[model samples]
Target: YLVGGGQNHSNISGGGGQNHSNISGGGGSEPHVQGYKSQNKFLNKEILELTILLRNAESRERSLEVKYVALEAKLCQVESKYLVLLQDLKSPVCSSSEQSPAREVISRLLEDALDNTDPAEHAVFKPHPVSEYDVFGFRTVPEEDDEEEKLVAKVRALDLRSLSLTDPEVSVGVKWENYLSSTMNRDMVHCPELKALMRSGVPHVHRSKVWRWCISYHTRMFRDNLAPNYYETLLGVARDKPNPASKQIELDLLRTLPNNKHYSSPGADGIQKLRNVLLAFSWRNPDIGYCQGLNRLAAIALLYLDQEDAFWCLITIVEVFMPQDYYTKTLLGSQVDQRVFKDLLSEKLPRLHAHFDLYKVDSSLITFNWFLVLFVDSVNSDLLFKIWDAFLYEGPKIIFRFALALFKYKEEEFLKLQDSMAIFKYLRYFTITILDWRKLMSIAFVDMNPFPLRQIQNRRTFHLEKVRLELTELEAIRQTFLRERDTHTDAGPLCSDDEEDN
Candidate 1:
């Protein structure tokens, strides 16, 4: 009976549900059918659950697709912004031909503003050739100061120069009094002649000796550490460093003092010495390493002075007058002086400044090397040396004065310049051509009283001592204070005896 029932049930399941009576013949019970129906219901419930999960997954996928599209749009916007920035970066912003109309008008106005003063009239205001050596001889003490005169006389009688050099023995009373007096008057009193000499140009022949004297006196006064070792160290550095600037220096060297018969020998000793000094200087100051116009400056120096004297003069000029950092790799000081030049132009030659501003002509483009190397490559070497003579006696102020003087001389042609490039080209060619050597030097150095000698000396000495001493003292004090503070901090707070009683 079980076998028969199994066959009948198998047949009913295999067939497409023929009849309920077929299952009854096999004794299939209502409970069995109910159980089968329950099984089918459970399978349907699982299928429904799977369908719901698939729909949820599809919804999540669609949401993710939307987010991805939004991100892609943002990426495309960023790329477009970057492309625009890149395009701008690649563009040349400062082409000279694109100068604004305001610049051209201003240039014309500046040219017109010049009084059309006769060059000869301008020359009349020019300083006569004063005796460079005795320029300050006429300086006098004020008539109103009798007591000061007596004091000065007494001080002068003490032979300060001899005493300063020899360290002479003195009576205790005198020694104490002099020390007090000197302490009160630490700065050297400049004679009237010296002041006049500083204001006027140093004659070319006397420049070398005068420069050496000035450097020696200042070195002794300031007790500069580098002064003693300077030339020797410079030579040693030159020997050690490779001749990196030789080719460039050589190229401009001959061109520097051209037309001067003194420098143009087939075997000129002066020229050779000038080359050596310049090379040595470049080696010594490797950060400046080498610049194009320095050889020209050295060559000009050699034409007027012997090699050793020329070197000393160069040392004084670099260390004392022009900005020390001007010749450095950064050329930062030149830029600063360029700004000062701009200010001078605006104040003294407003028309030129306005034209320059309108045309977008950066003063730096022309003036950077002018101030940095003191127009070594710009003007005639003879004129350059004369400029140097005045520069040494005066200070960096001569550079600005000369720059303004140059613009004043060249106002007309410069006004017609259409762009910065044209302006630079004009400066490179025409400006240097305006002044003959004598005239240029005469213009730059003669009749200028911008800086006092005492002030310049003081500035040199101050920088040498002040910053170094301050830093040293500050470090020492900081160390000691820190130690004391740390000790105090480490010691715990003291307990009161009254608290202990509690």
Candidate 2:
């Protein structure tokens, strides 16, 4: 300290010593004049350094943006020229008018220009962009929160269904059918033989028996693991004491794959089956009640198994396989999957993720419904059913495999897209185009070492721990609210709607 004229001066620094500053008593917080000047000098130096750094960053960003545009433009030009040249060589005369193939060229550009995107994303899509989805019909964008993602406003699958496969895929499917028919009657649920067969593909003829065998005999036989009386008891509750969830379940049921013959009418067996399953589940897990997406799960499960088995399949899907909060009242679980998926995308497809971020397009906006319905209307009927078979045997992580594949395959188109709606529309249009399940799954699961069971479980464990902590906090808050509520004279019934805020 230095004695002054009616003032004192001392030195103070954040660490060991002080500079020309005073930090003594009431006005000690104020820096000395000299200290202030020194700080300003230091700050000016830092500002200049930071400004230079920022300028460098901005310059680099602009340079990269230019490079990206040039790459895309060159890709598009080369891609268009190649398509035109091929068409001309194939045709008797070379002319652009006879062969108006810009769309095809664009599709080729996206797929063939492998150098334009990371190989991981590049590998997922096919060389062709043409899908039956492009030719078939209209698509209405679903509302943001609409769980019944019946986005394919119209689908004409019957005409295509009548067409013979006329390929080796049919024979392979047949081979699996004959093999399952011969050996699946055995008492044991799981075997190396069974797993190998499923990995190939379960035949439609043998699906019912195969699914039942897998669930009943193959899955764990613990009572707590089973939803034995849950279905029956819940159905009884739904029958006797009607609840609020029942109405929503009915509305969702009406919209659930409305075009599918089995579900078109309210009086149909499929609709009734869906209603019973949803209602029973609502009663079974009152906390979640009947979430919108569960209807699709039950509907598909019902298609493959009996009602009881179907209920159990959904139970396994929602409770055991999936991150639990997925279908909760608040949908807290699906959000976690988004976070995990975002990390995976960043690692697996950094370029695509950066493009999305640069355009301010959130991954969740494009991915939520995909996870919710397991690619219900996102892909064609054939793909959806096949994914379900793998999804069940493998676990919920298969959806991630499918999702990563969706982005990877469509990276070029995704990159070309500038706005959120364009990206979503592109996804809706292109994802369903690839009717070949074999090729799609090959890129997703086999081509690269996709996420393994352990990785998924680790992330899920972290999410569950987070949820547990949140619940503990929520419980404490609830207790505090109760105490606070009691202190008020006009504290109504403790079960007020406001309590949900906790």
Candidate 3:
């Protein structure tokens, strides 16, 4: 029998009874059995706990793997964006196929017409040619020398205004017709086969048609999407923007077209229309938002175009023609253009560039408005309109050409400048005085090859790449931070629990 008490035993009395009757096995076995059962229970519990902990750790690792994979995908996407931008920067400025052969021929013809000609030939093209004979095509016969002198004196003495002058209405009509004919003839003469034709001279009567033709020509050349209802889409964009800059645009509405008598009045329909268009544009390009010089540009546009057309034209200009960043807050696009201008100065006028470097005269001092408003603020309205005509046809290159022409024209004064301030003042005010519209334009466009179309494209591309890379880096940093924060948050509880248990 087994004793259930501590340190007790029972005896087996059959064969071994004569040897010894010490039965302590029952008591010892009971305590030993109990200890073994308790140890087994503890081992089973520890194993089960370890298995659960391992499963949790594996789950956490799997989650982290998923997150890392997603982050890597995002990083790749950002890199790809930057690569595309880089590639764009490496491309050419303008494709040779942009202009048709006919356009090129027309442009060449226009250039030939404007080329150097004899004064007599130029006079022939003028509206009024001085004549030696009377208006009726009659030549008086000469008498004696003294009598001839007297006859000439008498003819000269006739009241200057009494020469059988046509009616004022008829005269005005005839003169205007002559001006129109003269302008058209000049334009046709300068026409080239591959480039857009420039409408030279004062196109007072043909302003609308000339503007429309230039716009159409560019639209075709750029293959810009001018689909039906595009204007409506633009208007819709205008209606959507409700930013603070829109208010500033409203305040400066009348001030924009200040010189235009029709739109100068406080409540004029033209002024209101211009306001609407500007405000709408402000709304449409909220990223650029509204800048100070844009109002001036829009105001100038109103002078040449109807409100609706002007709005669309401005949209085309900012979105397609000019560098995208030109109108933005940083004005980085203009800044880049200025950098290019500096490069141009260095190449074309090393002396001027050296002078500028010595004086520390940065291009930003005066070129901001030059590129932003296309010299609208500096040039006369009539001349500015003509520049705009060419601008519409050639894009921003016209502005660069115009700038180079200015530098070329004023190289003498610029070379002599003592300091940056003087250079700024000269560029700000003096350059305008020095330039003659026809002469300046002739210099700007005639055989000009300073900044080629390819270089411009490359510059734009380079800037775009830079922006993309910056954006990508910023996004990468942001994503990294976000991921770190998420990781910290996700592991916080688990770590805290582990620490407490430890």
Better of 2 and 3 by lDDT: 2
Better model by TM-score: candidate 1 vs candidate 3: 3
Candidate order, lDDT descending: 2, 3, 1
Root-mean-square deviation per candidate: 39.1, 30.4, 40.8
TM-score per candidate, in order?
0.45, 0.60, 0.52
Q: Highest TM-score: which candidate? A: 2
lDDT score, candidate 2, position 170: 57
Whole-model alpha-carbon lDDT for candidate 2: 0.66
For candidate 1, lDDT tens digit of each residue in 1-502?
A: 3455457557546542533555656755664577567546655666687788989999999788667655654543443343343334322432344575644543333222222233354422221111212121211112344543422322222222222222222233344344335646453234654544544444444555556655555445434656665676777777676777766667766665544444555465556786778777767566776666566567656655666666665666665666667666655455456655665577666888898888887777777778766776576333455566556655676777677677777777888888877887787666545533334445545533353445434544555455447658889999999998888778966568997799
Compute the lDDT of residue 155 as modeled in candidate 1. Answer: 25
Q: Hey, what RMSD does candidate 3 come out at?
A: 40.8
Local distance difference test, each candidate? 0.56, 0.66, 0.59
Which of the numbered candidates is closest to the native, going by highest lDDT? 2
Q: What is the lDDT of residue 262 in candidate 3?
A: 47
For model 2, how does the per-residue alpha-carbon lDDT over 1-502 read when each residue is reduced to its tens digit?
A: 1133113112224411342233443344444555667656756666687789999999999788667655654544444354444444533432455565765554454334222334455543322121223221212223244322311221122212222132245566777766655765655345676655666667676778667765654245534565667568768878799687998887898788765656767886788888888888788788888888898888878776788788777777777777667898768788778877887888888999999888778878768989988888778666677777777776777888888887887788788878877875675578765555666777777754656778866776687678668878999999999888777747555565778676
